[model samples]
Target: MSNYDITLPLTREVAAQLRAGDSVRLTGTLYSARDAAHKRLNELLDAGLPLPIPIENATIYYAGPTPAPEGYAVGAIGPTTSGRMDAYAPRLIALGLCGMIGKGERDALVVRAIRKHGAVYFGAIGGAGALLAEHVEDADIVAFPELGAEALRRLTVRDFPAVVVIDSTGMSLYESGRAEYLKSLK
Candidate 1:
C-alpha cells in the first residue's frame, strides 16, 4: 500500500488522488462529532440554519473522546461506528465535506456521495483510542458542549495514522480485500 502524508483543510484535488487501502498520516485541523451532534447538525440543516462549523472542504472525524487525563490534550479519542452517521453523511458530502475518519464500512448511498463529490473516507483503527490520542496535538469544543463527550470539537492532529477505507472513486477496501481473500482460498 502507498503511504501518504496529507495536510488538511482537505481539497477535492487531494481527496481524488487517494485510493482505498492506502495508508495516510493526516496532519491538520479536523472537526469531531458523534450521533448526538450529528442529529443536531441535521436539525439545523433541515431548518436552513447555518452550521456551527464550516463544511466546505473539511474532514469530520466520527468520535467522542473521554475526559482528558491530567496534562493530556484529550483522552482516548477513538472512532465511532461510521454507520451511525450514514443518514446525514450524504447531505454533508454534497455540501462539500471532503473526508471522514471513522471505523467500519459506510452504506452504498454514502459511498456514492463520496464518489460524486470527490470526497474520501479514512479508517482509524478500532480499539486504539489511546494510541490515536497521542496524535491529537490539541482539541477544543467547537459547538454543542452540553452533549459532553459527544460535543462537536475542533481537533488539531499531527501525523495521525489512517487508512483510505473508501476513496473518492467509490472504491472500498472492505469489499475489495474481502474479495481478494476469498479468491485466494478458491
Candidate 2:
C-alpha cells in the first residue's frame, strides 16, 4: 500500500491510480449525503429533474454530522455505514460520481459500478468523528434543508484521512484483507 495526498473533485486519471489498501489524506471539497439525501437525489433523477448538486467528478461523503459547537466548523463528523447507501450508489456512479467516503463494505453491484465508472471508495476511521471534524474547514447545506443533519452539505476539508477500500480496478481491501488474515491463521 502507498500513501497519497489527494484533492477532491477527483478525476478519472487520479482515481485510476489508487489501489485498494492505499492510504490517502484528502483535501478540498466533499459533499455530505446519507440515505435520505440519496433517496431524494434518486427521485429527482427519475423525474428527469436537475440534481440539487452537480454529480460529475463529485465525491460524496456518507455522513450526517451533529450540530457544530460554538466555534467549530462542524461537529463529530464521521462516516455512516456504507451499506445503507448501496442501493442508490450505482445510479449515482453512472452519473459520474468519482469517489465515496464511508465505513463498512459495499455490495458487489456497487463495486462493479465503481470499477466500470473508474471510481474509488475510501473508508474513513469510523469512530473518529471528533478527530475527523478537525479536518473540516467549512460546511454549508447545499440542499434539502428540512432534512436536518441528513441535508446535503458541501464541506471543505484539509488533510482528511481515509484508506482505499475499493479501487477503480474492482479490487476490494475488505475481501483481500480478510482472506489474507484467514490464511495466516490457518
Error of 1 at 37 (Å): 0.4
Q: TM-score of each candidate?
A: 0.97, 0.97
Task: Itemize residue pairs with steric clashes in candidate 2.
Answer: none
The CA lDDT at 90 in model 1 is 98
lDDT (Cα, tens digit) per residue for candidate 2, span 94-130: 9999999999989999989998999999999999999
RMSD of each: 0.9, 1.0
Candidate 2: global Cα-lDDT?
Answer: 0.95
Task: Indicate the residue-level lDDT of 116 in model 1.
Answer: 93
Report lDDT per candidate: 0.94, 0.95
